[model samples]
Target: MRIEHLAFNVTAPFEMADWYVAHLGMQIVKRGETGCFLSDKSGMLLELYEDAAAPALDGFSFPPATFHLAFAVDEVENLLRALVKGGGRQEGTLRTLPSGDRLAFVRDPWGFPLQLVSRAGATP
Candidate 1:
């Protein structure tokens, strides 16, 4: 089966949800007091849950670093420019992989890392 949903522990899910919807064009498909489920036009989900007041997972109080969520873009340049206009900071310059894929990074207001990528040979 394919991966369906992913969740990130966040400070304020409502505010963060709004930011994702605005910045990445994801839609708020569902929301609750402490969590939200967001979806793209294709119906993929990205969930966010409140966790600041809760104890750490596995007794570690550090931030989550297992993996980061990436938002693929048809045009990395346009996405980066829009993110910059929306107050997000560019993490680094676009890099072309040996396989010819292009990728770049940016950071959200709350410091979550996001990647924008275009597959090799795809029209930008």
Candidate 2:
């Protein structure tokens, strides 16, 4: 079967969803009372679910750390600047690989790690 979408738990679904839309230019494919479904111009989907019950997904959890999500980006610098301006913290520096691809790790306002990736030869 083909992978359809990814759903992530966050404290504020709308706020985090809008932040992604604003930063990465993804469209809001669908909106619900508890979360939002987002897709890029190519239609890859991500779901943001509001879960106030628990925020941390450390090793002491069920979902586990391997379930983390990442969003593709064109230019990591601009996105990092925008996120910083909007109160998001930089979890790590620009991690550049030998292939010319780069990635920047950042945490949303609610403390969820959001990975922004840019591959080699990718247009941003």
Task: Name the top lDDT candidate.
Answer: 1
Q: How accurate is candidate 1 locally (lDDT)?
A: 0.76
Looking at candidate 1, the ten consecutive residues that score lowest on lDDT are 56-65
Residue range 11-124, candidate 1, lDDT tens digits: 767877898899899999888888899997778898888877674223123232333467767888888899888877777688888998888877776767777888886642
lDDT scores in order? 0.76, 0.75
Question: Candidate 1: which stretches are off by over 4 Å?
Answer: 52-66, 122-124
Q: Could you tell me the TM-score of candidate 1? A: 0.81
Pairs in steric clash, model 1: none
RMSD of each: 3.9, 3.8
In candidate 2, which residue pairs clash? 74-124
On TM-score, the candidate that comes out on top is 1
TM-score of 2: 0.75
